[model samples]
Target: MFTRILIANRGEIAARVIGTARRLGIATVAVYSDADAGARHRDLADEAVHIGPAPVSESYLKGDRIIAAALATGAEAIHPGYGFLSENPEFVEAVEAAGLVFIGPSAASIRAMGLKDAAKALMSSVGVPVVPGYHGERQEAGFLAAEAARIGYPVLIKARAGGGGKGMRLVEAPADFAAALESAQREGRSSFGDPAVLVEKYVSTPRHIEVQVFGDRHGQLVHLWERDCSLQRRHQKVIEEAPAPGLPPEVRRAMTEAALRAARAVDYVNAGTVEFIADGSGPLRPDGFWFMEMNTRLQVEHPVTEAITGLDLVEWQLRVAAGERLPLAQAEIPLAGHAFEARLYAEDPARNFLPAPGPLLHVAFPDGARIDTGVGTGDRITAHYDPMIAKLTTHAATRAEALSRLRRALGQTHIAGTATNLGFLRALCEDPDFAAGRMDTGLIGRRQEALTRVPPPDDAAVLFAALAALDLDPARPFLGFRLWGSASRRVELVSGGTLVARDLRLLGPRHVAVEEGDRSTAFEAVAATPDGFRARHGGRNLHARVVRAGGAVSVLLDGRITDFSVIDPLAVEAAGGAAENRITAPMTGLVCAVPVTAGATVARGDILVVLEAMKMEHSLRAASDGTVEAVHCAVGDPVGDGTLLVEFTPAARRPDEAADG
Candidate 1:
């Protein structure tokens, strides 16, 4: 094995590679940009190298700079972790020219499967089942539209050089084809610098299943079963599992064999994934699966495969890069148990899953699970890269057990200072259809309302926050007693943008009554421990964990994390101010476009500006009918969160409305 290697990526994947390298006694070097100077991955490596600025183009995407760093640090090889330079054929060629081993497929192999259209053609030539589509090289808009018409309605326009759902659109009719194509091409150019796209038949009910395959320089190849990644939002996988449930035995065998054929056809080496979209109209069969695309590098969900197979895929990548033969025959690699992986991201599900980058005040993962993360408490989640916080995975002997464990693990995860999808993940795990394995790519879309609903703070959560804010000990006598008798204190909490005030009357040392409006509930604490408070309310006993960070308090109650901001009622009342009719950037990002100019009249819900951040586009809309007073930002200008982008003047009020007021 090579003694020293450089990881040519950032965040969790880089840290993940470092872990395996350390276990194998191989020294690892990590490269970082200006934004990731103090990143966890760099701190974990044996040595670190400063590349360039935070922008990926100047740092992570600069193949020559990365190669130079590797050579200067005496790294024997470079491991391009999933994204960025991982699938770039030119980068692979550059590394080879520098006489450093690239810990992945060769440049030729990557080129063969780099573009979706070309890869589809290659798969078809090799007898691999492929989705019917136009894989031609023509880029004219009219020709693409004609091809979509021939394919029938509800066709998909996918960028030839795209991944992670960027540069993809589904057109339901010919009328929308032109606009969708234009949008797709624009995103394609912005994201991949390639405007080429292909038209494909959109599967009405699709389940994403991919087979993990490995090959060595000695020409040995094998498949590591499959993972079902049907749970998706915005065309990105949210939850993934290994040993795909509800797949027929014959289908599994055929899929694995087909994957092996695809690998051999490209002369592929190292770790790669052959993705397939299966028809979910009925029971899964071998004939219902068709090739979608091949990811020419390690996948984000590879941990689920590792959990099921009891093998380290990163180690395999290193061994193959070192010219070692296949570690085991196909039959020797056993699939023992079912596993599930939930991608915990720092995003607000209610805000259409908008990326919310901020400091991680408190970060804690559950026990009995594997957490692969690149950030910790006190770390800032920068907008320069993906907003994925961690990948939590669990394995069990049965699918039911695995799902249950996954749900429990998600509930146990604690985070603060920024919004997260922990509640959404918990709801997904508890979904009946998901539990029964009736999942598809549209599952999240179909059940979005229920899955993203933010539950109100319960009484237990309010009480816990009150105790933490007041520094009151439930075990002590006369905790909230006045000179004459029990005291009544008003506690104010803010949750999910709604402010709630409750009156707490201390009846005794361990007893209190909480009054909210006309409703009141009495609770008696059995004991107060460092972990949580066990209390009885409404004839039921419950334990709620209290996590206090700064002025924010998060209570984990009944598998739901309810955050509360303990506020002073007097201060809140005194600080009230008139609303400023201004549209601000929701998060730090570059202003992509300003749709409205000064003095332009726009109705509520009209898009005023578009901001690009975290690899996604978000629009700032007018809050009310108003005229744009001034445009504060121009296209290509970088802005921070809450930075005013546009100022608007409210429309004139009617005479009757003014008289009433």
Candidate 2:
């Protein structure tokens, strides 16, 4: 094996590679941009080097700078994790030219699959199943539209050079084809610098499944079964599983064989994935699946596959790069129990899953399961990179057990300082269709409203927190040595938009009575920890981690940490509020275009503006019909959440309508 290797990537993948290298006794080098200077991966590697700025074009994509860093650190090979330069054929050639081994497929293999149209044609010629679509070289808009017409309605326009859904569009009718094509091309150009596109038949209910395969220098190859990546939002994977649930043994065998054939067709070596879009109307079949594309490097969900197979794919990459033959043959590799992986991202699901970036004040991950993370507490989730915090994976004897463990693990996690999709993920775990394995690409979107529903804290939990906060001061005894009956203290708590005022009468060290307005509720408290209280109300056990701050109490109940500005009842009765139609930016991104003009009339749900952030276009819409008063930002401007985009006044008939909040 090589003595030292350099990872030409960042984030969790870099940290993952460093971990494997350490176990194998291989020295590792990490490359970082200015944004990732204090990142966890930088400290994990044996040596680190600064590449360039935060933008990928100047930093991670600079293959020459990466190569120089590798050589300077005495790295014998470079591992391109999965993005940036991972699939860049030219970068592979450059690395090979510098006398350093590229720990992945050859440049020739990557070139063979660089463009979707070309790659589809190549796969078809080699007897592999290719989706029925337009794989021609013509790029004219009219020509592509005709191809879409030929393919039938509901055609997909995908960037020939795109991944991660950046340059993909689904058109339901001929009238929408032109607009979809323009959007796809623009995104493709901005993301990959190549706007070339290919039209394909859109599967009505798609289930994304992919086969993992690896090859050695001596031409020996084996397949590592498949992963079901059907859980998605905005065409990106949110959850994945190995030994796909409800998949049959026959289908598994066929997929493995087809994957090996595709790799052998290209004389492929190293680790790669062959993705497929399966029809979800029935169980997977040999003929029911069609090739999507090949990821020419290690995948983000490779951990699930590793857990099931009991093998280290990165170690295999190192062995193959060192001129070794295949370590295990197809027959020797075993498929064990089921595994599931959930990607925890710093995003707000309620805000249409917008990326939430900020300093991670406290990040606490579950202990039992394996967690692959690139950031820790004090790490800043920069907008210049993906906002993923970690990948939590669980493995067990069966799919049901794996999912149950996954739910428990997620519930045990604690994170603060930024919004996340944890609540949404928790809802998914309890979703009927998801738990029953009736999943498709559109599952999340179909149940979006219910899945993103916010639940308010129970009244009993709130009352316990109020009582606990009162005892935080040691000088104030349990009964306060009161001369009369128990001295009652009034406190106010707000959660999930519901405000409640509680009257706390401390009965004793383990008992209290709470009164909200004229109604009264009894609570029994047991001191679990000095900082938190365990309370029981109406037969349900609840935990309240109470922290005293600014004469108020912040209570963390049921994993949803909330702050309650506790104030004297007489001090807050004077405040009041009104309903308003306030416009706010959905996410931190550049204002790509403002469609509304000053004083223009826009109806409800009208497209007011478009913001581009994290390489995705989000259209800010008008919630009510009104006359536009102002636009707070211009095109090409950077804005954050709640950044005003436009203001509106009611129609002349209701000129005195209430303001928007």
Candidate 3:
């Protein structure tokens, strides 16, 4: 095996690769940008090198800089751990030219599958099942529209050059085709620098299943079963699992064989995934599924595969790079227990799932479960990178057990100082359809309301927070005692823009009553664990915990732990003179484009501007119909969240004397 390898990436994937490399006794080098200087991945590596600025184009995508770092560190190979420069064929060529092994497929293999249109054509020529779509070279908009017309309504326009759902759109009718195509092309150009797109049939009930393929230098290849990644939001996968639930034996065999064939067709080596869109009716057959795209590197959900097969794919990559061929025959790799992985992101699911970036005051992941994370307590979730917090994975003897374990693990994950999608993930795991293995791409979208509903903080939770905030000790004789026979303590909390106050009355050392206006619930303390507290309230048992020093309180509810702060209420006074009518940037990012300017009047629903942050364009819209008083920022400007972009006054209400209608 190679002595050292440079990981040409950052974040959790880099940390994950480092862990495997360490176990195999291979030294790892980490390359970081200015924004990632203090990243966990960089600190975990045997050696670290600074590449360039925080912008990916200046650092992660700089193939020459990465190769130089690898050479300087005496790395035998470079592992492109997904995203950034992972699938770039030119980067592969550069690594090869520098006489350093690129721990992935060859340039030729990447090129064969880089462009969707061309890859589809190639797959068809090789007799691999491909979706019926326009795979032609013609880029004329009219030509593409005509092709979509022939394919019928509800077609998919996908960017040919990139993946990760960046440049994809679904047009439901011919009337929307032109606009969708224009937007898709613009986003495509911005994301991949390629405006080319292909039209394909949009599967109504689709399940994303992909076969993991591994090949070696000796021309041997094998399939490592499959993963069902149907749980997605805006085309980005949110959750994934191995050994697809409800898959028919025949279909499973066909998908495995087809994935292997696809890899062989490209002379593919190392790890790659051939993804397919399958019908959700029943089991996935080779014929029922069509090739969607192929990821040319190690996948983010590889842990689930590892949990099921008990195999280390990264070690295999190292072995193959060191001139080894097929560590084990296809027949020897056995599929064992089921596994599930939930991608926990730092984003607010209620507010349209906007990315939330800030310092992680306290981070506690579920113990006894596999958690792949790059950030720890005290680390900052930078606005310059992906807002992924961690990937929580679990394994069990059965699918039901795996799902149950995952749900419980998600509840135990405690994160603070930044909003997260943990609540949504918890709700999703409890979703009946999801538990029954009947899931698809639209599952989250379909159950949007229930998924985003923030469960009300219960009596026990409130009592715990009150006790912590009041600095009341349970051992004290007068912790909740007062002068009167009935003593009441009131505390305020800020939930988003809403202000809520809770009244608490102590019955005894172990009992307390919490009231929010007309409603009241009683809570009884159980005991404290290593992490936090467990309590029972109104016949509903809950868990709550506290660490009093940092002005933050961690609470465990329904087996899931989340952190909330003791709102000082006095903090809002600090914003005394700031204009309240202004809409500001929510995070640090370049102003990709300003669609509006000073004196431009807009309605509440109008999109006022677009800010590109972390490679995603976030549209800032007017909160109410108003006339612009000032525009503080301009196009191409870098802005931080709360940096005022525009100030406006509500539109004047015309005088109506109950006359003219």
Candidate 4:
């Protein structure tokens, strides 16, 4: 085994690799950018090196700097953990050229599957079922449109060079084809530096299932079963599980065999995933699935596979890189139990899942579930990198038990200073279709409203915040609530952009009556755990925990977290008015484009500015027809959250009004 190794990545994956290397008694070196200077991964490694600036192109993607770091740190091999430079063939070649082992497949294998169009063609040649579409080299818009017509409506146009839902669009009809293609090409060029795209049939009921395959240098190959990653939004996997739920044995066998075939065709080495898009419309059949693409590296969802198989995949990678034989024969691998992985991202589900990048003032994950994270309390989720805060994985004897554990763990996760999708994940766990294993790619999109809807803070939550803000001891009664009997204490809270004032009356120790407006709910503590108080309200018991940080009180009640800003008595409130004419950035990002100039008239819904953040583009548009007064930021400018980008003349007239005048 190599004495030392380097992880050429950041975030949870970097931390994950360092842990395995440490367990194996190998010194680990970590590379960091300016943004990740104080990252957990940097501190976890035995040695750390600064690569470059915050941008990935200048830091993580710089293969030469990384190789130099690995060589300087005496790393025998480099492990590209999943993203960034993981699947880049050129990086792998550079590492090998530097006389260091690349702990993954050869450059040929990655190059074989790098492009979607070519990979589809290769899979077809290798006898793997591939989706019926155009994988041709022609880039003509008319040619692609004709092919889409030939394939039928509802075709998917995706960039050939990159994944992650970028440079991809779904066209339902011919009328939308041209615009979608243009957008996809533009994004493809900007993101992947390749404008090539392929058109494919859009499956109506798609379930994303992929088989984990491992190969050693000696040509020994094996399969690590499958993971169902159907729970997705914009092509990004949200929740994943091993031993794909409700999969027929025959279908599973066929998919695994095909996956092995694809790997063999590429002479693949180390760990790789062969993803398939299967029909969730009915019982899985051998012919009901088609090849999507092969990820030429370890997957983010590998923990579920590891949980069921009872093996360390990273160790396998290390052994394989050291030219070892396969650890076990295909039949000897275990699949004992079910496992589920939930990706907890620092994002707001209400605001279209916008990435919420800010400091993690407080961070507390549940004790039981395995958490893979890089950020901690006082750390920041910056706009310069992916906003995935952590990945929570749970394993149990059954799928139901595993899912239940996942939901429980999500509820226990406490974070402050940024919005998260914890509540949405809890709601998704309760989704009937998902709970019963009848999920599909469209499940989230279908139930998006119900899933993302933030429930108004209940009386219990508001009362908890009030108590925490007041620093009242719930275990003991106080005469405070004004000074006399029949007096109520009024405390103000801001929740969901609205102000709420609750009146609390102390009935007795461990008992309180909370009233908001015309309604009243009495809460009495039945029990108190270290985390929170279990109280009985309206004949039922519930739990509530409150934590205060940086002038904000956050209350976690009944599996939901709500942040309430305490109203300062000495502070004056600002009067509210409709500021719809002002167009500001929703989050920190780069001003990619200002389509409108100063004094330019724009109609409602017209694009004014294109801000790119967290690897996604958002078009800020006109709220209503108005003339632009100024464009504050130009293209290539970095902007912070709520930074005003453009302003329209206040109460600007519509086109019809101007014509009449």
Candidate 5:
């Protein structure tokens, strides 16, 4: 084993690598950008180095800077944790040239699997089955359209060098092919600096299954098993599980064998994942699976595999990099119990899963579940990187039990200062199709309405928020009571964008009555704990926790987080004025294009500007027919959220039209 190693990444994966290195008595060095100077991963390392600024190009993606940091810190090996330069073959070669071990596969292996088009070709050359698609060298738009036509309708245009659903488009008809291809190419060029692409047949109901495989210098290889990652939204996996539930044994065996063969074919080393798309419209079969691509580094969902198999994948990466043989033979690897990992992100599920970066005021996870996180309370989710908060995983003797634990664990998780997908995840866990293992990549899309529904705040939650806002302590004497009778006060609160007035009356030191509209309820606080309160409402005991920040209060009760905004009745209101026609950015990002210019007349729904952030592009459209008055931003300019990008003037009306009106 090496004396020291440098982690060439940030966030949870870097922290995860540091944990294993610390347990092995090895010193770990962390490299951070300006935005991540105070991040949890930097604090967890024994030594740290400042790479550059926040943008990936100037910081994490700079291979030379990362190599220099590794050498300067005397790190014998560099572990590129799954993102940025993790799968960059050039970075691996550079680390090796600096006389430091790259704790992953060789440059040749990564290059072999770098481009999807070439990788699929190589896999097909071997015995591995591949999806029928056009992987040729033609890049002309006309030629690609011909290929898509040949492949039939509902084809997928994917960037050869893209992953994580970036630079991918699904076109269901021939008329949409050209525009989708152009969009995919543009994103591919912006993200990967490569505009090459490939066309493939779109699978209607496919299940995403990937196998974890590890190899060493001695040519020893072993498969750790499979994970079902079919639950997805916007082409990204939301929940993943190991020992895929209801998967046939024959299919599992075939997938494992194929994964091992792919690794050997590339002479792969260290940890890697071979992803396949299996037909889920019917029963699983050995011949119904096809190779999608291979991830040349550790996966974000590796924890689910670890939970099922009693092995640490990071330790194995280190051991393999240190010239040790595989830790366990293929037959000797242990597999037990079902495991599920839910990716808890600081994002709003209702707003098309928009990334919402803000401070984490209160963060807590439930017991009996393993939480791997890189942020804690008081940490801010910056816009410079991915907004994933943590990975919560649960394990049990059976799939049903494991899923139940996951549902409860998610409910126990408390968060504040930003919108989260906790509610959406809980709903997905309770989905009948999901519970029965009847899932596909389109499950979330088909059930989006029910999954992303935000329940209205109940009376109990509203009352709790009111109490917290007023700083009312039920245990205190008098509690601002009237001399003759119980003191009463009316408070205004807002929940889910609706303002509501609630009446609160203090009955005694430990009792209170709440009235909203035609309903009224009496409650008594039996005990007040640091974490929450134990109270009796309507003859039933209830447990609730309150998280207060500024004028916002989130009441967590009965596995639901209901947020209420305290309204200030005396605050001055802005005068009703003519509608301002300025279009501002919805989030911090770089302007990718300005489709409209000043003096240009555009129809409603016309694209005005395109903003790219967090690896996705969002097109700002004209809300109404208007003439562009000004274009304030240009392509390549980084703008903060709410920065004005364009201004428009309503289209002028003709004299005859005005007379008719």
Candidate 6:
């Protein structure tokens, strides 16, 4: 085993690697960018080094800097944890050439699977059931169009070197193919430095299932069963599970064998995953799955596989990299119960799942589940990296039981300071099709409106917060001795777009009554707690963590966070509201494109600006038909949140009120 190793990554994966390395008594070194100077992974490791600035091109992707750090820290090997330089074949070769081990597959193996078109061809040649599509080398737009026509409409255009839903587009008709291809090529070039893409027939109802395989230098290999990653949003996985629910036994056997064959074809070693796109129109069949691509490193969803197998995959990687034999043969590998993993990300589901990066003012994960995370309270989810806060994993005797535990665990999650997709994840857990295991890649897209709708916070909890905010005394207002005089006050609070005024009267010590419209509710035990207050209403006890910053009050109750902006009668506001057709940056990020000029006219839904943040490209479209009055940003400009990117006025398409926020 390696006496010391360096993790060439950041976030949870870096932290995760340190955990296993420490357990094995291996000294660990962590590399961080300027943005991650205070990252948990840096502190968790035995030693830390600063590589470069926050931009990936300057930091995490600088293999030479990472190698220097590793050598300086006396690391025997480097572990690329799934992202950054994880799958870079050149980086792997460089590490090996530097007289240090690369704790993953060889450079040749990664190169073989680097490009989707070539990977598919290789798998098809090896009889691994490649998906039917255009895997040719021609990159001409017209040639690709003809191939898409030959395959059929509803073709999926994927970047040859893309992963994580980047540079992927699904075209439903021939007319939309050109635009999607251009967009895909642009994103692919910017993200992966490769503009080549492949056209594949889109599986209308598809399930993403992958098999985990491990190998050693001693020519021994084994499979760790499979994981179902069908729950996805925007082509990215949101939830994952092991021992796919409702999967047929025969199908599982065939898939596992195929995965081993694919791995063995390239003499693959260490940990890797063979992804498949399966037909989900009916029961899983042996012929329903086709090879998509192979990830040449540990996967983000590997925890689900670990929970089921009860094995430390990272430890296995270390052993294999140190010239040891495989831990267990295919049959010897233990596969017990079902497991589920839900990814909690700092994003706004209601805003089309845009990345919401800010300080994690309050973060609390419930017990009873294994949480793999690199962030906690006081940490910031910057736009420079992925916005994943943590991966919550649950394991049980059965799939149903495991999913139930997952739902319960999510219910107790508390986070504030920025928007999150917790509400969306909770809704997905309760979704009928998801709970019943009738899942597919298109599940989220089909029910996006319902899933993204955030549930309202507990009323009693919000009322108690309002009452507390109304108190003039800042210190222990909830514990005031108001028994001698029952004072009444009216306070106004606004949530989302709704405003309400309520009358609050002290009924007794630590008790109050609130009146709004014709409804009167009584709150008992209204005492202040360390973080917030607890109250009883309608025979139910409610707990809320109330935080007041300036006039904004945020209340978290039962994992639902609501920000209430207190209305002030003494404050004067400017009139005329925000300008029409004005679009601003949603978060701090680099501008990838300025599609429109100052005098250009654009229709609603037309691409105006493309912003790159959290390593993903987001296209900001016009909200109405308007003429651009100004283009304030250009490509490659780093802009902050709410920075005006474009200004425009309605072009008389309809009433201006239709454009009001």
Off by over 4 Å in 2: 460-486, 493-501, 528-531, 539-541, 544-582, 650-661
- What is residue 383's positional error in candidate 1, in angstroms? 0.8
Deviation of model 4 at 650, angstroms: 9.1
Q: What Cα-based lDDT does every candidate model obtain?
A: 0.89, 0.83, 0.84, 0.89, 0.89, 0.88
Worst 10 residues of 2 by lDDT: 472-481
* lDDT pick, better of 3 and 6: 6
- Give per-residue lDDT, candidate 5, residue 582: 82
Mind giving the per-residue lDDT tens digits that candidate 1 earns over 175-288?
989878977887788889998999999999999999999999997999999999999987889999998999989999999999998999999999999999999989999899
- Give the per-residue lDDT of model 2 (tens digit) for 1-661: 8999999999999999999999999999999999999989999999999999988889998999999999999999999998899999999999999999999999888878778888888888877888899988899999999999999988999999998888899899999999789889978987899998999999989999999999988979889999999999878999999988888888877777888888887889999999989889887787888888988889999999999999999999889988999888888998999999999988877768888888676677777788999999778888788899999999998889999999888877766667788888878988988898999998998999999887665565666566555554322435552436646766666654457676776666656667767877766654556756677777877776665544455556776555455555467464554224557876678887788888898887878888888778888887677788888889889887678777776563344553431
Candidate 4 on 1-661: residue-level lDDT in tens?
9999999999999999999999999999999999889999999999999999999999998999999999998999999998788888988888998999999999999999999999988898889999999988999999999999999989999999878788888899999998789878978887888999999999999999999999998878999999999999988899999999999899999999999999999999999999999988999899999999999999999999999998999999999998889889898999989999999999999988999988888898988899999989999999988899999999999999999999999999898888999999999999988999999999999899999998788888877777777776665564576475565788887887888877887777777888877888888873445765677887887877767886788888777899988888899876895476678899998887788899897788888998888988888878777789888999889999889999886335546667888
| Candidate 3, superposed: residue stretches over 4 Å from native | 281-285, 480-486, 525-530, 539-541, 547-550, 560-563, 567-581, 596-604, 622-633, 647-661
Taking the tens digit of each residue's C-alpha lDDT, what string does model 6 give over 38-98?
A: 9999999999999999889999999999999988989999999988899999999899989
Worst 10 residues of 1 by lDDT: 569-578
Please report how far candidate 4 places residue 51 from its true position, in Å.
1.1
Worst 10 residues of 6 by lDDT: 472-481
- TM-score between model 3 and native: 0.93
**TM-score of each candidate structure, all chains considered together:** 0.95, 0.91, 0.93, 0.95, 0.95, 0.95
* Model 3 agreement with the true structure over 255-300: per-residue lDDT tens digits: 8887877888889999999999998876556579999998999999
Taking all chains together, the TM-score of candidate 1 against the true structure is: 0.95
Q: Give per-residue CA lDDT, model 5, range 1-661, as digits (tens).
A: 9999999999999999999999999999999999998999999999999999998989999999989998898999999999799889988888898888999999999999999999998898889999989999999999999999999978989999998888999999989998889889999998899989999998899999999999999979999999999998877899999989788888999999999989888999999999999989999999999999999999999999999997999999999999999989988998899999999998888767878888898898889899999999989998888999999999998999999999999998999888899999999999999999999999999989889987777777777777788786667743565645648778788776677787777777677777877778888874566866667887788888988889888888988888778788788756664345889887888998898899898998899999888888878888788789899999999999889999887665434556888
Clash list (residue pairs), candidate 2: 580-659, 580-660, 580-661, 581-660
Which residue pairs in model 1 clash with each other?
Answer: none
